[model samples]
Target: MRRRFVIEAVMVATYGHLLVPSRPIDYVVPYSTILELYDMRDGSDPVMDNADDDAHVRGKISELIAFFEDPLNRKKIEKAMQMPWRESSPLLLSDEIQFTVVHAVDNASYGEFFDPIETELLLTGSKLNVPLLSDQFEFQDRLIEAEVPVQVYDIEDFEFAVEEGISTVDAGLRGE
Candidate 1:
């Protein structure tokens, strides 16, 4: 029998989508099986000359919460969450999983985020080695130096075409 290993941790980067498109429902929904950690930093500081970046972050979070709370969207979210584990290998087993949220604005901070966690699987494994962000290479090097039994997977690479949908209400407000 195949060993069933529960997802021990889900390390999510800021602004990264945890949901994917569901063609049948024509909506995006959250993953049902695994818990997600939004690795967010306290955005107390102003991001630009006058922009309140923290408020923007909070607004985004509120929008997501509203999406999840809608009765019309619940079924789709549930279906999406269950589909992967039922059709394929189980990503998470029945256990208490560790969910860590690390906040970093730059590479040095991102490297510091990994110092404490014992990461076994790093999603988008191929991208981990690629220096997409200033600190990515250094972060990868740290993972290597620490010998943290890490496995990488490029699961999201397959869902590259899905466009982020904007709500009709928002569109109307924008006079689109």
Candidate 2:
């Protein structure tokens, strides 16, 4: 069986430009580097300004991607994979963040939860019933204080909702 790894990372828009065809832009950035950029952006004296050019943004994104994808980093990730799941911290940076590495197939059925604004990425599935962290409630309160929206849902219920939506769409397409 082919194995796929999901490395949950903080989302960052390093570069964005309007395309003639209106295609959605996608950026692949390392989790830690993006967090650093996010902090800078949120800082009182931001590193980036509205006048920043696309070339600079693109260059930074490329540099960070290359840095993270280097052989040394790959070796680190592989080494982490070999450690006990509970003890291992998969992503090299961001001790503040937590992650659980599971098979990609398991993720498909159980679903993953990500709170971009709070930088909380979770790996969950129906195969495992992991308890929420004690501090998760405090984290949500912090998000509320920061005026960030928070929504909580059961994984199994979410999966059922998604499957129902997909089936409904399929039925509509088939004129049922």
Candidate 3:
């Protein structure tokens, strides 16, 4: 039997939707190897075991959403967070040079703000030696749908949207 895992990450980059001044973010990728990815559990609190790393990622996602509260200053914050990192190159050198894009949002309405960024990342991936040729490509098409309680953020008057359930994945995790 094939075991599945859900992973969530935060990223900041420029695209059609963002106002401007956003920077390419730097995130420490977890589950680097396929073996590590396969070992994750689907219990109520997957990240609770790795509190430090998970907390940092959640904080960044909150900060990113908060930045949206002020459209004028959005780009400035993104630019400040941008750091230089080695990105995949055009040459088909080796597997290490390839990359795939995984999308994540701290809140429910991800399709709103994330679509443009996802498009930009897809274009970038097209130039690399990655294996994301089709939307159904294994490993590349793993979409982890999750929901954190609305109280996770300091913002008030929040609304949540839910995606249609799929027969494959289970996302019944409780949040405090």
Identify the leading candidate in terms of TM-score: 1
Each prediction's TM-score versus the true structure: 0.30, 0.28, 0.23
> Please, what are the lDDT tens digits per residue for candidate 3 over residues 38-123?
22322235433577765554454444344332444334333423432233112111222111222212222444333433333332
Output the TM-score of candidate 1: 0.30
> On TM-score, who's better, 1 or 2?
1
lDDT (CA) for every model shown?
0.30, 0.32, 0.26
Q: After superposition, which runs of candidate 3 have C-alpha atoms over 4 Å from their true positions?
A: 1-9, 12-49, 73-176
56-91: candidate 1 lDDT, tens digit per residue: 654555454444445644444444445332122122
lDDT, candidate 2, 41-135, per-residue tens: 44455334654544455455455455445676555544544633322224332322223333222222212233442342222211122211212
Best-fitting candidate, measured by lDDT?
Answer: 2
Question: Model 1, poorest ten-residue lDDT window?
Answer: 97-106
Task: Give every collision pair in model 2.
Answer: none
Colliding residue pairs in candidate 1: 6-92, 6-93, 7-92, 32-81
